[model samples]
Target chain A: GAGVSQSPRYKVAKRGQDVALRCDPISGHVSLFWYQQALGQGPEFLTYFQNEAQLDKSGLPSDRFFAERPEGSVSTLKIQRTQQEDSAVYLCASSLGASAGGNIQYFGAGTRLSVL
Target chain B: AQTVTQSQPEMSVQEAETVTLSCTYDTSESDYYLFWYKQPPSRQMILVIRQEAYKQQNATENRFSVNFQKAAKSFSLKISDSQLGDAAMYFCAYWGGANSKLTFGKGITLSVRP
Candidate 1:
């Protein structure tokens, strides 16, 4: 599929363990986004990257959470010392990178992480 | 900060019937966009419909439409002749041109009964 692709559709991690989630945006897409969706709640923004530069990351919950799009095409969301509160579905989306904020985002199936 | 509110957490409707989901938002910007996204069991967020605040005419796509009231800051989605495939979680989102972040509501779960 030409859509955004995320690795490890599901991940189970133990407390204090470190985990990394990867996302591959559509080819040529300039904008990538990350979101966190918990049970019964809407997705909250995590971070955004434009090409190789991370433009926005204020949505990240804490310092323990880190995201990087070093090469611009693939992004990784890493968590250090996972906790039960960190368990949620992480979604990745991409856009054509047109005008600033008007482009529609295409989403991936998302990675569901369960922390115990 | 922009905030979207979805009062109804869950709703049920018979297949082939019409259902309306309500959403309200708070924003100070004049030019913005309202969107409704559907998330199925697959966890894929699909864009259903969108409305520009500057436009008076509502936006519609096949069986889905939106009733956007700019003055009241309300944007509701109407699904006509709802089908089983429409059963999913719908989220209302607000996007301002000045802000790159999308503000989303809690979302509503829709169930279709045959």
Candidate 2:
């Protein structure tokens, strides 16, 4: 892909329903990250992956929120029993590596999840 | 704990004019990174510029540049000759090596008047 790609640009889920959002990072990108952006707010980090290794999950808001990158190239963020407060944009970003210039992250268009 | 703050919620600038957005951060780490990212209505975050903590010189890319005050923990973005295409939500972010996650401020909506 020319840039990071996310599936289901928009999602509408009923409360208590589980939702899965997908992210496909750029080819050869060694770092991937997931973030949550509330309405009219900047993004907050949720989790990070260095290849298939989940280096950091400290940012995940709750136990209901989970993310995995089994192959290092693609990732999924799943939220169990969605609540109204879960409504927000889910963003994914990827970088070439964790080195000097790799700090620059390329973001996807993001998935706007609306829990009703 | 590290935090980034963007006190201003919105800013407007005349086309072809220049505009500077304000940002302040708090951190104890000596080695860190600062970034400015732009998110248009399309919702894709694009990196405008970045500055390393160790660098004494400001970072600039074309019309976009940053005024980094390491001592005050301030990093602001200046867009010269602003264009209507520049209209978007601009965010200030901080990254510490130990944290490994980007901390972002409440973004500022920038409108370029044509």
**Chain B alone, TM-score of each model?**
0.98, 0.99
Write the residue-wise lDDT of candidate 1 on B2-92 in tens digits. 9999999999999999999999999999999889999999999999998988899999999999999999999999999999999999999
Q: Candidate 1 has which clashing residue pairs, if any? A: none
lDDT per residue, candidate 2, A21-113, as tens digits? 999999999999999999999999999999999999998989999999998889999999999999999999999986333368899999999
Pick out the ten consecutive residues of candidate 2 chain A with the lowest summed lDDT.
A96-105
Cα displacement (Å) at residue A38, model 2: 0.2
In the predicted model 2, the residue pairs found to clash are none
Per-residue alpha-carbon lDDT of candidate 2 for residues B38-103, written as tens digits (9 for 90 to 100): 999999999999999999999999999999999999999999999999999999999886776789
Over 4 Å off in model 1, which ranges? none
Over A5-115, each residue of candidate 1 has an lDDT whose tens digit, in order, gives: 998999999999999999999998988899999988999999888898888898999999999989878999999999999999999998888425468988999999999
* Candidate 2 positional error at B76, Å: 1.0
Among these predicted structures, which one has the highest DockQ? 1
Write down the RMSD of all candidates, one decimal each: 1.1, 1.1
